[model samples]
Target: MQAVWKLSKYIKPYILFAIIAPVMMVIEVSMDLLQPTILQHIIDDGIAQTDTSYIVKMFGLMIATSVIGLIGGIGCSIYASRTAVNFSTDLRQDLYETITYFSNSSKDKFTLGKLVTNLTSDMEMLQRALTMLLKVFVRGPMMFIGAIVIVFITARELFPILLVVVPILAFCMYYFTALSGKLFHKVQKVVDMVNTKVQENLAGIRVIKAYNRKNHQIEQFTEVNTQLMKRSMAADQIIGVLAPLTMFVVNLGIVAALWMGAIKVDNNTLQVGVILAFINYLMMVMQGLMSSSMVLVQLARAIPSAGRIVEVLEENTDLTSPLKPEIKQIQGSISFENVSFSYLKETESVLKNISFHVNAGETVGIIGMTGSGKSTLVKMIPRLFDPDSGSVKIDGVPIGSYSLEHLRQSIGFSPQKATLFSKTIADNLRYGKSDATSEDIVQALQSANAKEFVDKLDAGTEHLLTQGATNLSGGQKQRLAMARSFIRKPSILILDDVTSAVDSISEKTIQRAIEEQFSDATKVIVSSKISSIRHADQILVMDDGKIAAQGTHEQLLQESILYQEMAKTQAEKGVTLSE
Candidate 1:
């Protein structure tokens, strides 16, 4: 609940709506309070006196007040909805923006499922609670206080009954609210777990089916979902008891008021009309208590959600652009000086004391077995994950000295996975350069050896791809990813195993095209196949997390055992040694 209060600033933009809702609710509650007094007058002054005209006039007055209250209630509901919806919209937007700015390391701290739940379910809880608070929060206390004041003046003796009822209701409300808050927090955690399992199952549906693990996934989902259900039921049961307990206490107060009021009426000391009005006011007080409890329950649920949202909102991303970036231009040169990094500090470094330099216009090949830190080395160029120690520089400037946007804009990176969105072929190709012309798209696709197959489609570049481009073959997707980077015409291009899925002929064609098209661009190609990198200006053979050898293909064959062994292994596998 404290966390919920911290987010009240989000309501500032909708302050007008917030103000209007409570004000309207006050009007509605005022009318409600006035009704019991009006009914008292109708009974005592009109009906008891046998004045039909007075009765008609009083009934008409009651109808008019009812209409006014109805209007007020409607206004409150409309404005409250607007306030909650618009507030959540802005908050959700800011939360999403904050998440987008998170670096790879920061993102690793939260699961994809948890992030999605925060953006959706947690946000919805806050929105609903806000709406309830705006309406019921104002109405409840007004009804309670207004009814109490009226009862004290009209029927002072019956006020003692409220003394006992109010305190008892308050205690029950407080106790149940505290108990449910802890239970609801547990329920929300299980909901996050359930969502996580669902997300994993869906994202890896293909793999699950291929491996025949569908039953195992189903069992995992059921286990988490059952836990969610049980927690939800436990929280609801506590909240459920609250309403009945409140009603029971209110009904008991009503009975006590009736018994005492009948005695006073028979004794000719208290008016029957006044006793009826006192009972109505008592019910109004009870209504107020119920509304107050409802509001507290909503706050309890929203408290956990608000805390989760605030956690992300207040997170200080480890990666940020320098206040004043020193590097204004990039000439494609890259240098890593005595760099060492690990995903976790307790773990061994993924890249250990790595030092290298790539001049503008040079092609550097990085060859390593799996788990050799090949991908981690290239990722630092774009600052996806900053090095744990030492400095990586572009040109002569430290990478941190360049603004993140400017530095990344100067380089094009195609990862091994080749992620493509569900959009037209042209849309994905133009992702790197939004304003690319049709000819520019064609040239890039041609360079990546992808245009031939794309041209065969009836829609050609306008062809719509399915999500992850699953409709296309792996080789085709890889080529398109290369084309996306090529369209950028970046000063630095890093391709990690982009040609792995393509056939030998396509690989050679793509390699030749890259050399011819971006002759002056600094390119680092990571490949397992020796033939893919055999003709590079420099070749780095990575062993463990260190560069075991670095030289041109001919020089490495003569001097480096690792390079000679790699070449020999490829030769045995029927890969050509001659270029």
Candidate 2:
């Protein structure tokens, strides 16, 4: 209910259509209820009088009223659909935008599959609920009450049967619905599991095939698919029971009504026409109750989805910008002051008391083993994760003081994973600068050593890359990612092992290009290869989340035992390092 209440904001824009839909539904219900009364008049007045002209007139009137009812139903459906569409579309758009602003903590809160479910399946269920609220929800109660009113007017003696039967029916409805409601949340959770399995399988299909795990993936999917079916059936089983339970109760009332009415007819106290109308009213009441239960069943299923959506909507963003942010002009200087961080709040820190400072336009290199927090250190500069203890300042201003947009725009960061979108080469490059000219793109490509291969392609800059840039070679993808950063021409550039997959020749080409083309920009490079950082202005060797050594190439080789061992190991492998 809270989720529905939160969703009501979306209905405000489409209020006219929302209002019109229910009014039209009421008109339809009223018209349908009037038919039983008209039938009574026709049977009692026209047929009983043996007047053919009167019977014909009554039939014509019935058809005309029936046509009007049909029109009202059609209007109701059309308008309800309009409101539902607008509501779902707006809510989905807003949900997606809300997800985009999620911080590191918020990202950790929901899995990709669950997030996808909330945006798609959950929103869809709420939309269906909205339509039901207008059509079945509004129509059912009105039909029930209207039927009761008609029976009271036409055959007051028969009303006692309803008193006996309605309670029994209501009890059945409550029992079944309560049992079904228990399974709704379980169904949604199982659906999330299925989605997660499918997502993992599709994304890792290459690895699955390489390892001959197709059978294993199939078995995994089967388990989740079976679980979903079992839970869905458990929930629907109660609704299935409600149908026959209500029918039995309503039919019993009909039999009782006929028995009593026949006794009255024999005594000349009741007409057959009135008795017929009374039985019809009882059946209508049964239908109304059944229809309402079906809507409630849908409501049961949608409630969990609503709650999940509300969970997402109400989640607090872990990272928030200050009300008054400083917008300073930056000069590429960088510093880390006693900074410490961990992915989890109470866990062991990944970067411990890290502190460093580099003047404007200086190129600093970070070299370390796999788990030494090399990537995590440079990430602080862009404020990807705020340090737990100390401040990371850019141009002497704490990075947090700047707006997220300005802070990110000031730095060009090429992450470890060289992600590329499914778009033309030119379009992907323009992500750095939406209005980048052809000359700007060409310069960036050449700087990243990607120009020669790109020119060889048939479309040149217009060549299309598939998702993850799977169509391109590892070297090509890395070069393209580097090119994207170069396109920005930012004051600060952080390349986190962006050239690891490239060949030695290409690696040297990239290293040389960055040193030459981006000399004015402060360059921070995190790599495992000593050759990649040996010529850097300053090399910081990290070991176990701490800076083990920092010095120039010659000074580090002489004084740092770690640097000596690394250089010795590379020499034994006969690997070339830049002199």
Candidate 3:
């Protein structure tokens, strides 16, 4: 609930709509309150006196009030909707922007599905609740208080019935709201789990089919979906009981009033018109109670949704540019001084105390077994994840001294897994350099050995890719991803196993093209194949988070036993540099 209040600023921009909605609701409620009094005049004054003209006048007044109330109701709804929708839109936009700027370490705290759920389902809940708050929230209390005042004035003797009924209804509302709050929170969490399962299965559909695990996937989805159903049913069942219970208590009070009024009429102490108007106001009170309960239920669901959203909104972006960044001329010289990093504080370091240097325009190759911290080492240079200890420097200055945007802009990184969006090939390529020309694209494609295949395509660069670029082969997507980085023509280029999917001939062609195109650019290539880095100026053999050996390929072949074993195994398998 407090978390919801923090987002009040989002409503500030729509304050005019916010103010107008409740004001319109007040007009509608006031008009509605005037109806029973008018009905009393028609019954008591006109009908009893047998004056046809008087009855017609009172009926006309009642019609006019209903018309006015209708306009007010429409106005309230329009303004309330505007406020809720705009508020949600603004908040969602800011949330998305915040996520885009999140550091790799910060992003790791949430799953892809969880973030999507927050952006969609969770945001929807808040929007609905805000709409209800502006409309029903204002209307309910006004109706309740207005009915109570009317009841006291018209039938003071019967008002005591409401005293007993109101307390009982309030208690019911309080108890059920407390119980349902916990249940609704659980329902939201289960919804997140359901969404997560769906997202994971969709993203890995090919893997599941290839592994012949469709039945397993279905069973997993069913389990999560069923959990969601059970939690949702539990929360809805509690809310369901509230309406019936409220109506029952209110009806009993109306019955009590009718019996007491009948006795009064028998004694000629109360007129029929007065009692009829009193009953109408009593029904109004019942409606008010129902509306109040609905608001409470909405608030219950909104509390958890708001808290989840706020958790992300208030998440201290663990990484940000310094207030005073020292921008310097970058020449691509890279250095790591005793750098060590671990994803978690208590976990083993992925990269242990490591020291290395690469001079400007040098090509360095990092070769290691799987899980040997090859990717982690290169990621540090771009400030994706700052090391827990020691510093990474570029051009003799600490990387932290440079703004993240400036530092990252100068470095071209092609990650191990190529990520492409659902867009035209030209659009995806331009993601590297927003204003890249057709000639630039062609040159980059040639450098990445992607030109031949792309030229054969019917649409060429205009080809629209499916989601995840699943329409292309793994090697083709990797080449396109490499071409995007190549288009940047960055001072320092890091290719993290980009050639793993390519055949030996294509891989060799790509290596040669890289040398031809990026002759002056510092390049760091990570690979498991020795042939991929055979012609490197320096090759680092990584063994369990530490650089086991660093030297030229031939030098490591003689000095490093790990490199020797790897080279001998590849040779025995008939994998050769010439091939």
Separately for all candidates shown, the number of backbone clashes (residues 3 or more apart, or on different chains) is 0, 0, 0
* TM-score for candidate 3, residues paired by index: 0.96
| Residue pairs whose backbone atoms clash in candidate 1 | none
- Number of clashes in model 1? 0
- Candidate 2: which stretches are off by over 4 Å? none
TM-score against native, each model: 0.96, 0.95, 0.96
Candidate order by TM-score, decreasing, is: 3, 1, 2
Worst ten in a row by lDDT for model 2: 318-327
The CA-based lDDT of model 3 is what?
0.90
The digit string of per-residue lDDT tens for model 1 on 1-579 reads: 567777889999999999999999999999999999999999989988999999999999999999999999999999999999999999999999999999776666777778898999999999999999999989988999999999998889788999999899889988998899899999999988988888889889999999999999999898998899899999999999988888899889989988998998899888778888988998899889789878888888898899999988888997899999976679899899998989998999999999999898899999987899999999999998888888998887999988888998898899999999999999998888999999999999999999999999899999999988988999999999999999999999999999889988998889888888899899999998888888888988888999999999888889989888888898899987665
Off by over 4 Å in 1: 577-579
lDDT of 2 by residue, 344-387 (tens): 98899999999999989998999988899999999888878888
Q: What lDDT is reached at residue 249 by model 3?
A: 86
